[model samples]
Target: MLAVLIPLVLLMSGLSAGVLLGTQLGGFPLLAALPTDRYVHAHAFFATRYDPFMPICFVGTVVGDIALAVLAPEAAASGFYIVGAVLALATVTISLVKNVPTNKWVQTLDPENLPEGPDYEGKRADWGRWNRNRSYLAVAALVANCAALAALAVLI
Candidate 1:
């Protein structure tokens, strides 16, 4: 079981971290710079692509980490897995609570007739902040996952 769970958790956590980091470093800045009309459309375009993929990766990572935490031979490895699970869970919670709703709200806008003001821009800023937070959490989870793997490797 460790054979399967170790690689599975690493793969899922790594993919989740990579995607979130890419969005933070590349995508968010571009979207933040766009005018409201362009931002709305661009956000909708980028947002839809990640729907099922990210959720699957994050959830899979969580489940794998939990399994690893329970099954690990070494107490340190199990602790690392527990930390990874918590961090991954935090990423999921933030995505559902903050980012998903923002994405949904962006999808509903007409773009052509968006209200004129700082309100919309503020929304974009808020979204970016939340994205950054989740990205950091995902990356932290990956690190914890790696540490868990390393601890197990040392035992062998």
Candidate 2:
């Protein structure tokens, strides 16, 4: 049971982390570069097109890994799983606390023109910073997950 679960989680979490890293590297820069209106509109456009499923996939896999960790039979193996889960969960927490509200604020602005009140550039900068941090966390979780899976593969 544990053997099946560990590898299954590895596949899911690894795929999610890989896609997230790519999207953050590839599309997020576009959001930072555009002017206010274009930035909002472009986010909407990209969210509708390129990102509709990615977030769901990422969250699902992270949650799946956590669940598997909770269910694992051995203490040492569970410790590695929990470490990966905590790192991945931190990324989720950051996304909810930082990214979502900032995104909501950005989306509400007029895409035809720069928004009034608060510094637009600063908001984008802060958002990008938060994203970078989350990306690093995701990378760490992915690495931890892979390591755990590899160890489990050898044991099982």
Q: What C-alpha lDDT values do all the predictions have? A: 0.93, 0.72
Estimated TM-score per prediction?
0.97, 0.81
Off by over 4 Å in 1: 116-118
Collision pairs in model 2:
37-111
Please, what are the lDDT tens digits per residue for candidate 1 over residues 1-156? 788779888999999999999998899999998988999999999999987999999999999999999999999999999999999999999999999999999998888888656488788999999999999999999999999888988888
lDDT (10s digit) by residue, model 2, range 1-156: 665766666776676677668768787877877877777788666545525455665566577677767776655566677788888888878878997788777667677665467787787788888888888888888788776666556656
Each model's backbone clash number? 0, 1
Model 2 Cα shift for residue 142 (angstroms)? 0.9
User: For model 1, how big is the CA root-mean-square deviation?
Assistant: 1.1
Off by over 4 Å in 2: 48-55, 70-75
Candidate 2: worst-modelled 10 consecutive residues by lDDT: 46-55
